[model samples]
Target: MKTERAISDEFMNALVDDQLDSDEKDYALREANQNTEFRERVCELRALKEMVQHAYPQVADAPPRTRGRTSLRLSHLQSLAACFMLLMIGGTSGWLAHDISSPASDNQMVHSLRALQQNDFGIHPSKYVVHVDTANPIRLKTALDEAENLLTTAQDTSQPSQVEIIANGPGLDLLRTGISPFAQRIALMQKKYPGLDFMACGQTIRKLKEQGIVVELLPHTQVTPSALEQIITRRLKQNWAYIKV
Candidate 1:
C-alpha cells in the first residue's frame, strides 16, 4: 500500500493564503487546531506574507512590463529601486522556505528571517538571551524550560544555539545561594548543559547586602554588573536574540 502523504508546507501555505477550497480548507483548519506544528507554520506563513506585502505593494491597474521592456522611458534610479526590491523578495522568500523545517515541539522560533537578516545573527549557533526579571520561582523554571526548548529546537534545525538567562530585580533569587528555592535544579541543569549560563545581577546583590541579606551565587552562575546592560550588550555587541520572560 502507498504511504499516506503527510500535509506539506505547500498545503499549509495554501491555507494561510486562503487558496484552498472550502472542504480542503476546513480539513486543514481542523488539522491545524490539533497539530501545533501545523498551526505555527500557518502563522509564520501569514506573517511573512504580510511583511512582503507591506514592503512591496503592487500598484492597482499598473501595466505589466514584458522582459526587458518598459512602456515609458526608465530612469536609472527607478531601475535600481526595482532591482533592489526583487533582490530583497528573493532573499527573504528563499531563506524562510529553507530555514524553518522541524516539528513544533522543537521549533519555537517562528520569527521572520527578515528580523535576523537586519542584524548579523542570521546564521547557525544563534545566540539567544533569556531575560527573567520576575521574582516568581515558577516563572524562572518556565523560562529555563523555554530556553532549553529553544536550544533543542535550534539543534533540531541543525544549528547549535547558545542560551543564557539573565535575572535581576526579584528575579535575582533564581541564582542566589541560600534563598533560591530552585538552586538544586539549576545546578543539575548546569551540569547537563555546560554551555548554558545563569547570570546573577550585581546590582541586586549589592542591594541585598545593604539590607543585611547574604547573597551567595550558585556554582556555575556568573555575576554581571547590570542585567539590562548585559542584555543591551548582547543585542548591540553580540547580536543575540533577547527574549524576556
Candidate 2:
C-alpha cells in the first residue's frame, strides 16, 4: 500500500460537516477510500460529532449570552471538549491491521460493545442497540449481521435478549420501504427473531419529506421521534449495549 498522505484536522472536520468544496471533497473522498487510517479518522470524527450532538441536544437551542460571536466560540469549545473525550476513550494507539476477509463484527465498534458487556458492573448484557447512520453498503450489511449475531447468541444460550437496530441520516435508507436492499432479509429476520426490532428516525424522515421525497418504512419497522434520543435516553441510559456501524 502507498503511504497515506496527511490530512489536517480542520480539513477533516469540514469534510465531516459537509462544508468541503467540490475539489476538496473529491480529494477527501478519494483519500478516505484508499487510506485505511484516513477512513478511520473520518469515522472517528463522525462518531465524535454524534456523541456531542446527543450529549447536548439543547445547546443549539440555548439563547446567546452576550454576543453571537461569544456563543459561537462557546459552542466551538464544547465541541473541542467532546472531541477530547472521544480521543481519550479511543486512546492514542496506532491503527490495527484490518483484514477485510474477517467478519465486520470484528471491528473496533464491536470491540467496544464486547468490552462494555464484559465490564458491566450490574447491568445485564441482554439489551443491544445497533446504530447505523451511513449509507455505506458494507456498514449497512454489518449492522444487520451484528444484530442477527447478537440475537442468535442469546437464543442459543437461552438468554432473554432484545435487539434493536436504529437507522438515521443516510442509514435511514436501510429501513426505507423500497430503497432498502435488505428488505426481504429484514422481513425474514423479523420472522426468525421476534425480539429483534427495527427503528427509523422520524427526524430523518421529515427531512427527506421536506426535500420532496416520499418516506415510507418497511412493514413492521417502527419510527422513533429522534434517533439520538432513542439511543441516549431510551437505550444507553437504560443500560443497553451500543454497537455503532
Candidate 3:
C-alpha cells in the first residue's frame, strides 16, 4: 500500500532515467500503470526531464550563445515549471499540466490516446495494440478483457479488426508457459480470433536468461526484439489504437 508520496523524487527520477535495477524498475512501472497519481507524477517528471535536456544540450553539441542567454533559458524553463506545478496544485483536471507546459507534438503517446475518440478505432480495418508492462493479476485479466472486448465488438459489427496483446518487463509473465493463469483462455481466444496476436518482449526474455533463468512462452506467442520499439514503430506509427492495460 505504498502511496505516491512515499515514492521520492529521486526514485522517480531514477525510474525515468532507467537507472533502477530490475526489481525497482518493475515496481515503478507497476505503480505508474496502476496508480493515477503516480502516473501523473511520472509523466510530469519525464516531461520536465525532457525540457531540461532540450534547454541545456550537451556541451559538445551546443554552441555558445550571448552573455544573457543562460539566464534567458533558465527563465523560460522556470516559467514552464511554474505553470506545470500550478496546474497540479490547483487541481486543473485531466493532465492539464501536459497541455499547458508542452506542445501537442511533444506530448507523450498516452496524451494522444487520451484525446482520441473512443468510437474512432484508428484506421480501418481497425487495429489495436494492448500494452501490458506489469505482472499484476488484475491488470493481466484486464488486458485480456480489453482485447476480447475489442475483438468481440468488431466481430459483432462485421468490421475487420486486428488486436495484438504485447507484453514486456514483468508483464511477460502473461505469455510465459506454466506461469500465466490465463494460458487456456489465451489459447481459446487465439482459436476464436484469427486477427488476434500475442507478443512477448525478447529483451525481457534475454535479460531473464542472463540472470540464469530459463524463459519460455505459451504456444503461439511471438517475440519482438523490444516491446517499446514494436509498440511505437510498428503499431502506433501505423495508426493502430493503443490500449495500456
Candidate 4:
C-alpha cells in the first residue's frame, strides 16, 4: 500500500499480473501517465505478459477431449492451463489443485468477489464448473439457463475461456446419445460458447454399460473418470464458481 510515487518493482509486477486493488491500480496508472520512465516500465511489463500468454497458445485452444476416455491424454494440457492461470493470479501458495482426492474451495468472500468481477472484464475469465447430477428436466434446464445467463451477461468486450459443465450420476443422461431431452440444447450452447465444456462421467457410463443400458454420448461430449473429482481438481482448485444442480 505504498504511495503511487513510491511504487516499487513488486507493485509494478503485481499490476502487470492483474493483482492490484482498484484504488492502487488507479494510482499506478496515474503515476505512469505523469512519469515517462514509469510508463515505459509499465509497457515493458505488459509486453512480457503478452509474450508469455502467446507462448502457450496451444494450451488454451487445444481440442476438447472427453473427460472419461481412459486413453485420451489431457492431464498435461489441463496442468499447463492451470499453470498459465497461476501466472495471471500471481501465486502458487494457495488454491486447489486438479486431482481426484483433493480438498475443497477456499475463501468464500474471494469467490463471491471474483464472481461479481467476471461481469466487469474478460481479462481474467470468470470461471464456472457446473454440476449436473440429475436428469430431471427442471434441474437440467436451470443449470443450462444459469450458464447461458453467464455468457450472455459477460462484458461485451471479453471472450471467456474457463467455463465447464460436468455431468455425473443420473445427470450423465443429459449427454447420452438418444434419450436426453437436453441433447439439442447442449449442442446449441456448445456452439455458442467455444470454451464451454460439456462433460460426461466415465464411472456413470461404465455403470450403465454393466446394467445393459445403451450408453452412447453426444459426439462432442468430453468424458472424465469422475465428474465430482474432475470438478474438484480442475475447476474448483482454480477458484471457479461451482454450481450444483
Which one is best on TM-score? 2
lDDT per residue as tens, model 4, 103-177: 123233234334433445333356777777667665688788978877776635475545678887778878888
> Lowest lDDT 10-mer window, candidate 1?
105-114
Error of 4 at 141 (Å): 0.6
Model 1 clash pairs?
none
Per-residue lDDT tens digits for candidate 2, residues 157-214, read 9999999999988999999988999999999999999999999988788878878999
What lDDT does the true structure give each of the candidates?
Answer: 0.62, 0.72, 0.70, 0.64
lDDT of 1 by residue, 23-137 (tens): 7766875786699877667656755664565344332224557755535434332332233233234343444333544344212222332345465644444777787766765
Question: What residue runs in model 2 are displaced by over 4 Å at the alpha carbon?
Answer: 1-119
Could you give the candidate ranking by TM-score, starting with the highest?
Answer: 2, 3, 1, 4
TM-score of each: 0.50, 0.60, 0.56, 0.49
Best by lDDT: 2
lDDT, candidate 1, equals 0.62
The C-alpha RMSD in Å for every predicted model, in order, reads: 16.9, 10.3, 10.6, 18.1
Better structure of 2 and 3 per lDDT: 2
| TM-score (C-alpha) between model 2 and the true structure | 0.60
